[model samples]
Target: MAVYVQRQLDRQPERTYVIEGDADGYWKLAQSLIHGEPYSIYTPPRRVLRMPGFPFFLAGAMSVVGEDHFRVRLILALSGAVACFVVYLLGKELVNETIGLIAAALTAVSPVMAGFSVLFLSETLFAVTMLISLWVLVKLSKVQFRVEDQFQGRLWSVLAGISLAVAFYVRPSWLLMLPLVVFILILSAKEHRTAALTRGLLIIVGFTVMLVPWVYRNYQVTGHFVPTTLWAGPSLYDGLNPRATGDSDMTFFDQENVLNSMSEYEMNQHYTKRAVEYARQHPGHVFELMGAKLVRYWKPWPNATQFKSFWVMAAVSVLFIPVVFFAGYGAWVSRDQYLLLLITVGPIVYFSLIHLIFVSSLRYRLPAEYSLYILSAVGFYQMCFSSRQGKELNPE
Candidate 1:
């Protein structure tokens, strides 16, 4: 892990120095956090347009290391290393230690996973938070939900909720996962109705506690209640507009130049209304665009045209195909284990549905990739060892 971090630091300037416009905003936001200055992105009102978690994370790193570009990359690399360990824990809790190690190894070497860590983006931190949340839920699954276990089960549920809240702060779309997870927990503990209800309530409480402050801050800034960041409308429009081409293209709005004059809230409303009208007028086209997005979401290569390096793209495809094949086999073999299946397969399915509605890209698909590692490990173990042992690990 240390070696990986070092290599990333060495290549930081050449490999990861190209900051996208969105990333520039985040970097400036972190700088503002550090220097206590008013920061604006796109235009004035200078509010919390993006999620706050990653900016705060960058701020902490900059505070310690004086905001050097390499230092920021180092922080992300170390975070990636931590994610690898968290993947191990998630795998071990779901299956066995051998699977855990295998998952960790896959995560460490995955081209997308490793590359994301060195880039100035929120995906790495979001992935780590997501894994931590899953780890907590996996632990909670083992609890009996009996009277004796209620207190401990509630604690684990709260921790899961808190971790999920952190992830939500990193990416507002994560908010979609909360209810689905709660629903899974309810179904998993159907026999222990009282305990399940209590656990669910506690989890909601924890999540609400984490989110309320941010909500209040947004209200203060915008003079209206906003649950998450301000980018959702633009993001939605980015995928649904007439010129979407089944991927994110900010030029649709940029060409009009109306967003420049509007406040963030107004801009969001304008784009959202336009996107909805477009979808209404062109339902067949909307479906076609969604189909294209689904394909792009699962494609192994770089989704953007600029990053399409032939050899690198080929290598990613080579690595991704087998892992996905093995992962599918593993998911099939473990189909009977409800809790394990939910943890391993739920995010991929859920996020796929999300992209069907919004936008799709490799970067958008990353949070669920850790779960794929877990499934791939299971597939490898089943192919190599389960047959020899003549038994399967029961996910009770």
Candidate 2:
């Protein structure tokens, strides 16, 4: 993938520079952390810009390894390796170590998850943020009514909130995580008494603090106080509707490029209003879209590429025929454990809402897909264990 991105850059560095900034604004607010110098927004090919956090993360990696494109790709690969381990941590907390190992192994191999590891993108960043959030959630869920541990629960819950807030920074859609946080607090209240409330409040406070600066910056420049990326809603509306005219092969970014040229500021204004009005006037369309996108979320499989994401989808479909049922069984068997369901349901609900309300992007669906794998691993690892009980294994 680095080879591909570098080749594109070599051929037309001019096109890629726009990713660093656009006509709207610069990263002036977050500049100290993300870039070594005050840099203008440059257009990165569709591949790199999708992962905004990648350049910053990889820039650090480049500083250590030598400032080159290979360094960025190397860093992405390494972060992905670490992210798989993080998924293992989540799986271990949700199920058992065997499940954890299985989840990690699958993460390393899964086409969708592994595919992003090659780009200078934020898919890897988003994955790390989300997995860390889940891991922190699992820790905070263990919070109990030990009054003496007030500070402990508070700290853990704050950490969890910070994790969630960071995820939103990495991928703005993660803001939807608060609904699940609400459920977790309510469920935990009975067990932990007032500390649960304290935990919840602390979590909210933490997230608010983390999110304030971005909101303030948006307010400063745009006067609207948007949270993350400014373009997603209007971009999605135009990209998916009749206006985009993208074929099945084109990506969300490709459609956006053409739409960006064809449409102007006034069009985005119109599209924004129309998107809201459409959702209001035709609520059924929203539900229909949600269902369709959810299917796409699963069907085309995660590891789609220049050569194929649909074929990977087919393979996953065949593999998951039994995987889903076993997970349903395991989840049913673990019915009393809200942790399992909370982890499973949060991303699904969040992404479904994003798809229905906003524009659909394959990358937008990533966090939810990876979250599902932990549960899938529960079934896969368990079946592998049960079917092979008492059987001897040979080391390779």
Candidate 3:
């Protein structure tokens, strides 16, 4: 909290453009939402360029606090705190209380996480929402689906779906996780297949209920049934163009000059077509690009060009090495706990695959990074205190 407060006070004068174009875009979007006007100041008025979750939250904070940047940072700082708490709960649920405490402590002081809290980006909020969804899914996986407990199990599944729906609103990429989660539930509840299917149906119902209004709003404005945000095509093309360097490049779209004359939907279609054509024409280059993207997504250092100090980047990169090592060891040791392994590894896999097709950056990997803390805690506990009895000293 003190760190966040100090950073906010130090940077308060430049709050309006702290993160440059992205932060300014979010601020404009929030103002439009608060005023009940179209979100055109940043993108096309007819299309929703960005997801609505963080802007809505920021709009509420702005309304209550009278549009002050410090107050908004305070809200995000609170979210970072909540993310730490959620990591603790997730670690406890997966292993034991000791592991939970360790994970929470690491998350509380993580440089990447802390840096995000002081900015007006959606990464903090998205991390919190993703953690909440994972915690709920962990609870659901543990539920015993007896005939008498079917209602309780169904309720838990629905709640997990609702949490994930909130996460999807924050970052539409999470929508890809729905089927994966449902499959996991089905596999875990193999003894009661019918009950598992019922729970899955209820989850889908809950998710659809939460998502309908957003879809409807997009359709009404754009005259098309756009389920997610309208930037998918451009985002995909950003990584596929000939000048692509495994990081985001906005120059292709600018060079095309489609923004001035085309509708948002048309622009999206054009970009999609262009990216697909590129992939078709240069299959080997596409494969090489994906390999580079995987490296960028998982590399331990901050890859953004703004972090110019080599020594500082190397120091931060070194910090992540221990976490990565222990997480891999923890995953290997806990391989028998299939559901636990899924909970820890699912987000990493999901995000990696998505970024391979789009752009890869540290910011895009933030939501999954905390989950590694859970595995790291387990590894730390096992290495430091495991006895020769082949039993955990602090079993849940």
Which candidate's TM-score is highest? 3
- Displacement of residue 360 (Cα, Å) in model 1 is 0.8
Can you list the residue pairs that collide in candidate 3? Answer: none
For model 1, the superposed segments whose C-alpha errors exceed 4 Å read 1-16, 259-261, 389-396
Q: Tell me how candidate 2 scores on lDDT.
A: 0.61
lDDT of 3: 0.82
Per-prediction TM-score: 0.93, 0.76, 0.93
lDDT (C-alpha, whole model) for all candidates:
0.82, 0.61, 0.82
- What tens digits encode model 1's per-residue C-alpha lDDT throughout 284-322? 989999899999999988788766899769867887888
Error of 3 at 79 (Å): 0.6
How far does residue 130 in candidate 3 sit from its true spot (Å)?
0.7
How far in Å is the alpha carbon of 123 misplaced in model 1?
0.8
Q: What RMSD does each model have against the real structure?
A: 2.8, 6.3, 2.3
Candidate 3 per-residue lDDT, tens place, 1-396, comes to: 435554655776654444576777787889888899876564436357888898888898888876777777777788889999999989898887888899999888787788787677889899899999999888887788787887789899889889989999988999978888787778767678888989888888889999999999988888888889878898888889888878877866667778789888888888999999999999899999999999988888878876648885776676678888888888888888776678787788889998898889777887788888888888877877685546673447
**What lDDT score goes with residue 4 in model 3?**
50
